[model samples]
Target: MGQLDGLKTVVTGAGGGIGAAIAVAYAEAGAAVTVVDINGAAAEAVAETCRGHGAAADAIQADCGDLAAIDAMLEQAASAMGGIDVIVNNAGVTRHAFILDLTEADWDRMFRVNAKGVFFCMQGAAKRMKAQGSGRIINIASVAGRGYQSSSNAAYAGTKGAVLAMTYLAAHQLGRFNINVNAICPGVTYTEIVSNLLRDRAAERGVTIEQMKQEAEKSIPIRRGNDPEDVAAMAVFLASPGARNITGQGFNVDGGLINS
Candidate 1:
């Protein structure tokens, strides 16, 4: 039997990149996964991949930033999967700009999706888990939350900080209910999101994508960038029975990017 045999999981932002990787990982571990994303087609594609791995998976399309939408999605997920044992709040967005150049809209949008969406989704999922008497809620944060001075917009960083704070509060409040809440802070991962950013940077610097990737890898003490599977492996471990004693902790999966 797989590590997650018989577990029902819901993974947000599973349409692509890290989210898609997480969904597949959970499925491979024997969990029935609900792939939720803003993009219906992409979500379905991931679900299909999971199904191909001999796991039961379903896809749902909803704007995670909307409380009502999230509520509906959770309800559907619960109904489809019988009940949700784990929730991976991996949906997020980033807007890169200097503090002075960032608009109020950009700030709000980042908070809405990265912070607000996570808050309500966790709230909804926690409620169900509380009733079930057990659950795992893993929020995806970033090294930006630990205070990065290299680059990235202020808004994106702020939202990640909020995610870590929320994870702590949720873990404390839900511990008594047998619900485990935690946050995973990844450093530089080679996802489509980061790939696009590197591409843009390469263009701006009149360099090739390969050159930009090398520069990014040099910044990490590990001498290489993280793959989506790296983060997914951590998520699987956290959601497994072995991590029952672990909660309210913010794990840094950034290849020694932040020593703390």
Candidate 2:
């Protein structure tokens, strides 16, 4: 039997990148999944892929940045899957700008999705999971959350930092109800988001993307960039019985980029 047989799962931003990978992995593990994304067509495409794996999958078009949309999506997801067991808050966005160049809009948009969206999603999912008395909440944070890092602006990092904070607080409050809340911080994962960032960083550094990548690889102990599957594997473990004892923790999936 698959590790997560019969579990109900909700994954936000499942249209592409790390979110899509998580949805597919959850399905392969035998969980029914709700793929939520602001892009209706992309969400449907991912759902179809999940169905191909023999897991019940539904696509919900919703903006994770909107509370009303999130609530609606969760309600529909629970109804479609029977009950909610796992929630992966994997939707995020980033902007490249210096402190002086960062606009008010930049900061507002970053927080709206990365921090505010996460908090509401966590709150909504926690309520359902608490009622059920068992659930797993896995958030997709970033290595930038730990502290200042290159290639990202101050505002972007601040939002992830907020996510890390929320993960711990939610874990503490939900643990008594047998709900496990944790955050996975990824380092240099080659997602669409990273691709966009790389373009900007490459121009700034006057180097090719490959040169920038090779330079980054040297700093990482594993000497490799992350694949979407790498992050997906961790999500699978968190949803499995193996991670039952783990909660309120931020696990880095960055190839030892950050020792702490």
Candidate 3:
């Protein structure tokens, strides 16, 4: 039997990158999944891949930054899947900019999705989970939240720091309901977003993409950047029966980038 057989899962920002990887992994492990993203076509494409894995999957296009959208999305996902067993709060936004260059819009956008979006998703999921008597909520944070030196920007880091704090607080409050809350902080994961950022940086520096990637890996203690799958593996494990007892913590999938 698959590890997550019969589990009902909702993954946000699942159109691409780490979120897509996690959604596919859950489907492969036998969970019925709802793929949520702001990009409708991209969400549907990933949902198609999940269906190809022989698992039930639905795609919903909604912006995580909007509360009304979040409510509707959760309602739709729950109705389609019968009930929500897991919620992966993976929707977030960021841009590479110097602290001085960051604008009010940048901070607002990042907080809208990264901090507020994640919290309400957890709150919404926890409400259902409390009634169900069990659930798993996984937030996708970043090493930037732990004060990583080379974080993309101060505002982005602030948002992730909010996520980490919420994860811990939610875990404590939801534990009695048998709902597990955790956060995964990834460091230098090679996703489409990272690739795009690297592409822009490469153009600015007049270097090959491969060289930029290698340079990016240099700061990692293991000298390796994560594939989206690395984060997916952790998501699967956390949602599986194996992680039922694990909660109230942030697990860094950073290849030893930060000691704490």
**Pairs in steric clash, model 2:** none
lDDT of 3 by residue, 100-149 (tens): 99999998999999999999889988889898999999999999999998
Candidate 2, position 90, lDDT: 93
* Candidate 3, poorest ten consecutive residues by summed lDDT: 192-201
lDDT of 1 by residue, 1-260 (tens): 99999999999999998899999999999999999999999999999999999999999999999999999999999999998899999999884566898998998898999999999999999999999999999999999888876446788999999999999999999999999999999888888878778887788789999998888778788887789999999999999999999999999998787876
TM-score of 3: 0.98
lDDT scores of the candidates, listed in order = 0.93, 0.92, 0.94
Cα RMSD of all models vs. native, in order, equals 0.9, 1.0, 0.9
| Each candidate structure's count of clashing pairs | 0, 0, 0
Candidates in descending lDDT order: 3, 1, 2
Cα deviation in Å at residue 183, candidate 3? Answer: 0.3
**Residue 33's lDDT in candidate 2:** 94
